[model samples]
Target: MAGVYDFTAKSLAGEDMALKRFEGQVLLIANTASACGFTPQYRGLEALHQALGPRGFSVLGFPCNQFGGQEPGDAKQIEEFCASNYAITFPMFAKIDVNGNNAHPLFNYLTNQKYGLLGRSIKWNFTKFLVDRSGKVVARHAPTAKPEALFREIEALL
Candidate 1:
């Protein structure tokens, strides 16, 4: 029963934040990178966030550098790039691991609840976890899965 609501994580600003705050909202929690091909997915994610945020949907971005050092910039640089390019206004968290012993607790719990097509371990950057209103991990979207493909699932949960 250790779900997403049972965890806390650092924000992009480095403040501790309880995941419980997002307990009753539909969420698209993604592990992101600044220099990867899927980096452009931020636009789509922002689009989704803007379109559905008022309806209780959110896209939470977590910057990760584990895959080929794609998100190596400091938080400032990451912010500049995201804001300047995609105009993303959703929540963005500090850089963290998505797999292995040091993976972020929320992500560890998420991948445990919903494994990917290849398996449980995260394969690359931009992997997304969809969480329902009750803090349950509802689905896992791969790197190639566009943000638009997630609308139906999000709508169902909303």
Candidate 2:
């Protein structure tokens, strides 16, 4: 099976990013939106990144517009919004689809590794997948799951 490190995605800056850079680190891979009701969760996710980052953990944000057009922005806009509003310091990716035939390869592998409550397809923006240090998808979190609530699971992996 393809692991998280087997894929690459474009960063918000438009540079191709190889996931191998994150190998051996616990990861919270989240599909995000800038204007959604759960947008505030960015703060908590940033906090998690700051608190656990020194211990081989990081948060990867992938902005998506698939859900209600909430993340309608170009790469620069998305980057600016995240920095100005949430002060996000973690890596943010270019806009991508989380569902359908056009879905990014990384997201396809993620949903395949761990099915959500609704099945393999992502249900909404902010849907999160926890990848362990070995690059396996360990858990799938719903959009409603708070970032702070994931501390114990992340700590266990670390």
The best candidate in terms of lDDT: 2
- Give RMSD to native, each candidate: 0.9, 0.5
Taking the tens digit of each residue's C-alpha lDDT, what string does model 2 give over 36-86?
999999999999999999999999999999999999999999999999998
What's the CA error at residue 71 for candidate 2, in Å?
0.6
lDDT digits (tens) for residues 17-117 of candidate 1:
88888878999999999999999999889989999999998899999999999998988899889999889899898899998999988888888899887
lDDT of 1: 0.90
Which lDDT value does model 1 have at 25? 90
Number of clashes recorded per candidate: 0, 0
